[model samples]
Target: MKQKRRVRVMVAKPGLDGHDRGARIIARAYRDAGFEVVYTGLHQTPEEIVEAAIQEDVDMIGLSSLAGAHKYLFLAVVELLREKAADDIVVCGGGIIPDDDIKRLKESGVKEVFTPGTPLDDIVKWVKHNITPRQD
Candidate 1:
């Protein structure tokens, strides 16, 4: 039997948002689910997060924002990825996001926005179903 290649995911905190307990928890969940997780620590700019995503060569970029700047911050990262010709990278996010904004977020390129209380297993399953890992 062939072993499946592991998926690589980058969990990032963008903008001035300093509350990272949720980010940390999700990162751990992803790690525990057998993904190769790269976490960009707190207080990262959109540039920093995208740059790290490229450098890390991640399959997906997961943004965590709780400071009410999800619109700007999430879109910024998505835009940068497009600008850099890295649009193939999947992007997802989680935090205190409003239900009303979820549609706009998906339309703008975020594949998923997992709000607080979302099951960790659901996220794991989503990634497994959605992304086809890049071959090195």
Candidate 2:
């Protein structure tokens, strides 16, 4: 029997967000939950994040933004993925985002948004239910 490919997720910190404690924790949670995880350290541009996601052939991108640039930075990643025709890679975000912006983010192509205090297990379960590893 052929084994299933593990979900591959890229957790990224976009823009000038200097905070990464949450990103680190979630990366660990995904790893512990049996997903293949790649974490891009702090101070990453949306372009850098998108490029890394594509190169890594990730099934999804979990962008973390603590610095108030989620409106711009997060959308940029989604847009870049579309431009690159890699929109098949699911994009989601979390961290310090205002509830008001969450609606906009979702409408703009982000699959989901997780605010503060969201349980790690919930996030993992969402990934398991929503994402499938690339066959290639």
Candidate 3:
């Protein structure tokens, strides 16, 4: 079997949400799973998050939001990445979003959405399997 490159993932909290327990947990899990991980501190704007991802050259971005603004904030990050020609970076979200919103979020460019109770192993496995290796 071919060996996949180690994935680099950025865990970010967009918008005014100050809660970060989940994001931290995910970041640590990614690290333990042998993926490089970056965690952007809380209250980051979409632009800031995208900038960090580009600077760090991450393979994927995972957003966690509970401020009831996941739709706008998550989509904004995806749009910024698209505008920067960095759409190759896989984007995913996790939080208290409703099932109805998850569909729209995916349509807006989020590759997947994880609800509050999703297992970290599932998230790690999904990312490892789904991320497209960066060529540059």
Candidate 4:
């Protein structure tokens, strides 16, 4: 118990990624960890993700894409975050992304990316480490 703040999270599945078993599990893990999680259902676009994040003022955005469109979808999401001036929100993703794409995703402003087999504890740890109380 590190005296956590209210961590709001939005778990989304973008593109044509029809595989959401992992996403659902992650959302449940976050909820069990005492986070306020807003789960965006399948096939969400970048605009929708950003809109939800801003409207909800979430601390983190989690994307689960397995449709091999992660590269395009992720870039769009990052660009939208910048466009809406929501770059302060922490972003991470999990799915069937390749090793090379992970580096590129990080370069494109995604703070972190988790592939299949990543433990829920690792995801929770990343959020806890990255999100902080607003000092402003």
Q: Write the per-residue lDDT of candidate 4 for residues 27-104, one digit (tens) a residue.
A: 999999888899999989889999999999987789999889998998898899999888888788888999999999
- Steric overlap count per candidate: 0, 0, 0, 0
Task: Write one digit per residue (lDDT tens) for candidate 1, span 8-94.
Answer: 999999999999999999889988988999988999999999999999889999999999999999999999999999999999989
TM-score of each: 0.94, 0.96, 0.94, 0.92
TM-score of candidate 3 on Cα atoms, chains taken together:
0.94
Q: In model 4, which regions exceed 4 Å deviation? A: 1-4
Q: Report how far residue 132 has shifted in candidate 3, in Å.
A: 3.6
lDDT of 2: 0.94
CA shift at 86, candidate 3, in angstroms?
Answer: 0.8
Measured with C-alpha atoms, the lDDT of residue 32 in candidate 3 is 97
lDDT of each: 0.92, 0.94, 0.92, 0.87
Off by over 4 Å in 3: 1-4
Model 1: weakest 10-residue lDDT segment is 127-136
Q: Candidate 1, 83: how far from true, in Å?
A: 0.4
Residue 57 accuracy (lDDT) in model 4 = 90
Per-residue lDDT of 1-136 in model 2, one digit per residue for the tens? 8888889999999988799999999999999999999999999998999999999999999999888999999999999999999999999999988888999999999999999999999999999899989876
- Write the number of the candidate with greater lDDT, choosing between 1 and 2: 2
Q: Least accurate stretch of 10 residues (summed lDDT) in model 4?
A: 127-136
Note the residue pairs that clash in candidate 3: none
